[model samples]
Target: MDRKLNRELVKATALRSGYSFTKLAQEVSVSTESVSKWMSGETNPRPGKAIKLGKVLGLSYEQMFGVRDRTLEPQVAFRLVRNQDPSEEHHERAREMGRMYEDLVPFLPFNQFEAPPRLKSPTADYEYLDELCGSLRREMGLEADVPVSLPSIFNHLSDKLQAVVIPVFWGHRKNKAELAAHIYSRKTKTTWIPFNLDTKLWDARFWAAHELAHVYTFDVLDDEAGEIFSDAFAGTLVFPVPIARAAYEELAKVRLKTQKFNLIVEFAKRMHVSPICVAKQVDRYAVAKKQPPVNAEYDGIYAAISRMSKREKTVAEEFFGGEEPSVGQLLEAAANIFKSPFFDTLSKYLKTNGGSPSFIQGLLDCSLVDAKALNSELA
Candidate 1:
């Protein structure tokens, strides 16, 4: 049987519900065009889907088709490659993950997540970035001039920021949107950062710092300025001013181009960041100190670093003991190694709320067979 919705009531309720057209359609397992048609009175939903829609909207059928009421957009900070926008599919998947975070918060073992205080009138200027990074490093009990241990940083920030760190094996092959995602659920007031564990661990560290910048200064909607802030913040946080100044001083004393390149490469190796990150930071430091910038071109440095980075294992590979791991092993690694409560939370949600293995597959973005195996283990 089909149930006809009052078009005006549906539109009003959907708007008041604060769900985007895509998300609303997702929650109801329908196409956005179908949602559009239903809201426009061009179509009606089947009885089962209609009931599901009402439940997802937290309203009884009488209230959904009869009455209307109530609001928050998720703040999405995608760490995309330069000049690239994630595909709509990627955005939809990220939003679904955000929805899961919203559903899982009540079962969290700690207090409600609180965002770190936003910077007042934050600027992306070099001086401001340097000072902010220095202060943050001190707060994290890290030495300003030494390379940071990513494991320490991860553990510290996970507890300090009170954010969920979800490590995902998006794919073994890298893509533009493969590093990290920062999604803030306004409804839950929680920040959910999902790290793509397919990239090199060095790249992951830098990207993690970038997301940390987003978490700390997430005052308003993300914009170009916010991205600028995050990029600068990540570089400075990983390679502080003191370290950059020292590297600059060392490079200044070197006259040969190869010597300078070697110095930069060594700095990158020591810092566990890309050569471009080290090169750019040193140039920025030189400019800030009114010194001549390093006289090296970066055309070849990129390729050289790319070849060098292939030797390192990604976060997931390391967690799984450097071989293709089973789905169950991946879930265990996510829990025991990454210390992520996401799987446990999902397990509890399934047991209490009565869900299927398909829910696990969707939330973890895994195969149905793997999800079933994982479900039995979680059960």
Candidate 2:
């Protein structure tokens, strides 16, 4: 075998198996230096060691020997659009989630799964998008001007589009850039939207709609303009133009800043959107109608909403009648794919050969505890 191909195979297997060179060496009973040489093209594993390597990494001898099969790779290709530049760790985490979803497909109890046909144009303007949203609402059996039921919309998208809507719980409160991400696999025609859960129901709902917009316009929009269009689309989908016009008319009559702030809150609650969204949409509507924007007094409105004595239930809880689903639960479900023969073989090999929990954690981008829990589940 060509040393270059050997190096590529080693590197690719390590990534797919979630093992570092040292860890790979430990699993295969080879020295770290030997594994490094194999990966660097300075040496190749002996036949006996190569077989062990394949077993531990869940690859066939042909795969390790460079007889590559395209089918063995992730069947789905994903495009990720984040609000800001993500850290390397964040990227790895997202990629791990994608891989898990791909592995779960064959095990999921469903058939004839396919993503909805892309219905958006890259060159679509606001008018085109407006008509698109209205049409989509009608297709989904929703009224043109009614406030969208966020949970109902989620369930509908999940079923109709064959997409997974997973809520990601980021424990850090200050990380604002990592809002939501949309990942799609062209090969499998699958889409997954992992949204941030550490936000108000209204904000999370907007983010969900924003990601849905990305799914519709994935190939068309790749820059700042695409982002702007997605935001507009999300706002429109949540609060349609007719509803926005009526809210604008009513909000325009208020003169006092405090009064306006209160009114904006009420409008947001009624429409199931954030007050900030209502304020911005009201401004957009005013510009369209050639009227002055409402005096929303943004800061005061946020402060007042925050200072409210009664806490409203989140949209997820309200709709589902319980706590929002957690990322751990999703991962747990994905881990069931291990019951398949390939993953079962890997699990048996690890158990018999004393595989480290870190190997599973690294491969799945999960916690040590989670890795252990998954191992027990697989057992």
- Number of the top-ranking candidate, with TM-score as the measure: 1
| Model 2 TM-score on a 0 to 1 scale | 0.62
Candidate 1 clashing pairs? Answer: 16-70
Question: Any runs in candidate 1 off by more than 4 Å, and if so which?
Answer: 1-71, 81-83, 113-116, 173-177, 295-297, 326-337
Off by over 4 Å in 2: 1-85, 108-115, 122-124, 172-177, 295-366, 370-379
TM-score of 1: 0.75
* Every model: Cα RMSD to truth: 8.2, 10.0
Candidate 2 C-alpha lDDT tens digits along 1-379: 2213356766876898789988988999889998988887776664446667877887766666655444423222222323356553355345445554564455433345444766645433556656877887897788966777665566555655555665444433344345566666554556666554444576766776777777676656665656777788888788777777888888878888777877777878887888777887777777766788675545566666666523655434443445644444445432331111223433565666566564555444345675676566454
Candidate 2 overall lDDT versus native: 0.61
Encode model 1's per-residue lDDT on 1-379: one tens digit a residue. 1235876666677789897778999999889998887887786664445667777777666565553221364667676644377664466456656766687788766565444566777777899888888887888788887776665556655667766777776664345355788888877778878888786766776888887878777755356788888888899989888888888999889877678888988888888877778888988888778998675445576677678777877777666666778767777766666566777877787788876776776566655776788788775
Each candidate's number of clashing pairs is 1, 1
Error of 1 at 299 (Å): 3.0
Candidate 2's displacement at residue 366, Å, is 5.0
Span of 10 residues, lowest total lDDT, candidate 2: 333-342
